[model samples]
Target: MIVKPRLPVINRAHPLAKGLVADYPFFERGGTTLRDISGNNNHGTLTSMDPAVKWILTSQGYGLDFDTTDYVTIPDSDILDFGTSPFFVETWIKTTVNNVRQVAVAKADVTGNFIFEMGTYRTLTANEIYCEFYVSGLYPKVLVVDSSFFDGKVHHLVAGHDGTAVRLFIDGVLRGSNVSAYGNIDTASWAIGTYGAYSPPFRGWNGQIAKTRVWKKAPIAREIATLYADPWALYRSRRGIIGKAVAAAGVTYPQLERSFQRGAFRGIKMGVAA
Candidate 1:
């Protein structure tokens, strides 16, 4: 006789009753509005929001541009209110140049309270991409991705914290985890694209970004998978030219490549003349 393996059962009155149970421990479709940030009808890059700022667009992707003054500012009213517990931040980004300074795109206070930062640093010969989180301190708990892992290509980055430990993700895969001493992000003037008083100030972005989102509660593995699978479903259903190029060429969008190549060539010619 053939028999199926039995699954574990849990009481309905359990504290985790709202989420998936042990028997069916996976989230159903369209549970959260995280996809709505990208919208449901549009594709391509998220050009600009309702309020206009002096952000320089280096490529066609969401969060591709960085404003000199402040890319995005969250007022006290809209600040994500947490109850001294866990939280998560997720976004997809395409890096333009290796070893360049660029924030991972996050919300933070002016003095630096709840912030997520991602950038690259050059060693003797190679470059490493690293992510750090600061709740209320000078130094942060950092997770670094080796140069070989980061190739100036598109990657999905996720940071999750629960007052004691911090975790990092790349392309939906768990990369590294670290322990920290801080918790809860209660700050003012949350900014993205740049940290507080960092060098290469207001330089702006140089690549594409998509499906940027934030959640008040720490997301489980299944939710993270769903976000990675269909990042732009809520914002727009159809893929744009950029998406097509990536699928066919195994590289970034053609237009972005052309822009960078042309710009670099022009710069080289100018330098030779001088």
Candidate 2:
């Protein structure tokens, strides 16, 4: 005779649910951080930073007066770990040049292989703002933005190559797409606000930049859009109610929890005096 095994009954107060409830605060903390990165502190705008792992542009080196300030420079030794092929680059840029080349970020052999800046008219014309990436032995690939899309406003720009295709995003929207491969070139160091050539380096951006991030994986279109749509939301959620309340006021996690508990634990007295 075959005996039927009894099924395990799921308890209403299961450990999974309990853990989730207990850990909600931790998840909320991460949201707060995202809010901060997304410019919740200042007016809602993106920013950029130097790309070399340990180097950051100084205050005078990074703001709207980039034309007057000497370009912030980074040494090749600082970026020894960056791989050539699969990577992403994103920055927020404003230009001061009327009709000149302004490089926002670059990493290349000073003389030979370079992924640098290339553009003709700088007067916010169609395809006037763009970046060029040159692999050692391969044809260089260029990513351009139509002036109609980004123009002179503070805009978020992102570019990534994932072995198969190259993708570009403007303010979280996919604007350019192509297929390219950077085989085995070693891009030793990366600089921000200037081109890499010594003789006539593209000196300084004429605008502002903030919140630059580099990820190994090329973020998908949806993910990029989501980030652009509510850059502060992720950071805000991580902070939880207390942090959010402190940052923006009138909203607290405890207040929310109390409201939820009142509804969720209707019959059960949570074992505490009100």
Candidate 3:
């Protein structure tokens, strides 16, 4: 029997290089389309974007600015379904409005039909907000609370189900979690920058959002930490996947000096294979 060799992560940019389900760089100048660079066909349509002023550019590049009521929607498909399997979502957001709920990404419908919704929701305390990953009523998620996200600055946010617990990471730190358990997930259209489009209380996000990614896997803490430490790596990483893994996942690249060869492979770092 052949054994699969274990190797160090090639890029350490993010965990999504292997199981990227969707990617939105928010780079389209068309002002109406958010291209899915992941090649997963999960394209989104801008509800009310103006080519002239809807985008904001920084040293990192362009990002979509939402006005609470605006959001991007993706059509329903089989690949979007995550079921009870592990899954994760990551994105960069900047906003000061956290008094009420603000949805960053959601694929849910009321009346029992649901998948998941990740966003900032008002807590019992006045003006206090907490991040939530609502799976469904049957598997309601616990709040991942942290008050610093309302600072109106660029921050990395991540949430995921790691087969056991629902987790939330802010700026690469694991902030909170809850016991996670759910049956097969429903197939619903995806919405970004707001909650459900077919329902009320959209929980719109009034801010700039960019570099949203989804993966059908558990949360990888090291990957998140690396990305938070080197924010530019996120931008440096290629847009789409190269065949299976990320374009420069470092497997074949000798830059990292990581190596995984045939049989009883030594714990080697990637670099110019020699």
TM-score of each: 0.55, 0.56, 0.74
* Sliding window of 10 residues with minimal summed lDDT for model 1: 21-30
Q: Supply the global lDDT for candidate 1.
A: 0.44
**Model 2 Cα lDDT, one tens digit per residue, 1-274:** 1111111121224212221100101111111111111111211111242222212222211222244233434445322234554656656555535456666655555664565442223545544555456655655454564655345555667776666766677778877666766544344444555555443244556555544444445547876786566433322333344334435754343343354345753543221212
Residue lDDT tens for model 1, 1-274: 1111121122334322233211111111112111221112111112233222222222223233333332433333223544465767776666545565556554455543545555443444445556666655654655464555466556777776756677777676667678775555554333344543233234334454443555556656666666566443222213444345445765533344355445643432210101
lDDT of 3 by residue, 1-274 (tens): 2222221222335443678778776555445777776667788888866756776653233577888867888787777788778888888887787667778877766443546777677767433434444554565565655567777777888887788887788889888788856545546677888765556336778888877888888888997787566543433334433212423353422222122333223553321112
The parts of candidate 2 lying over 4 Å away from their true place are 1-64, 77-80, 96-98, 116-127, 143-145, 149-151, 185-187, 197-203, 232-236, 242-274
Would you give me the overall lDDT of model 3?
A: 0.64
Arranged by TM-score with the best first, the candidates are 3, 2, 1
In what order do the candidates fall by lDDT, top score first? 3, 1, 2
**lDDT for each candidate structure:** 0.44, 0.44, 0.64
Clashing pairs in 1: 38-235, 39-234, 39-235, 39-236, 40-234, 40-235, 40-236
Question: Where's the lowest-lDDT run of ten residues in candidate 3?
Answer: 1-10
Best by lDDT: 3
- Residue 198 of candidate 3: its Cα lDDT? 57
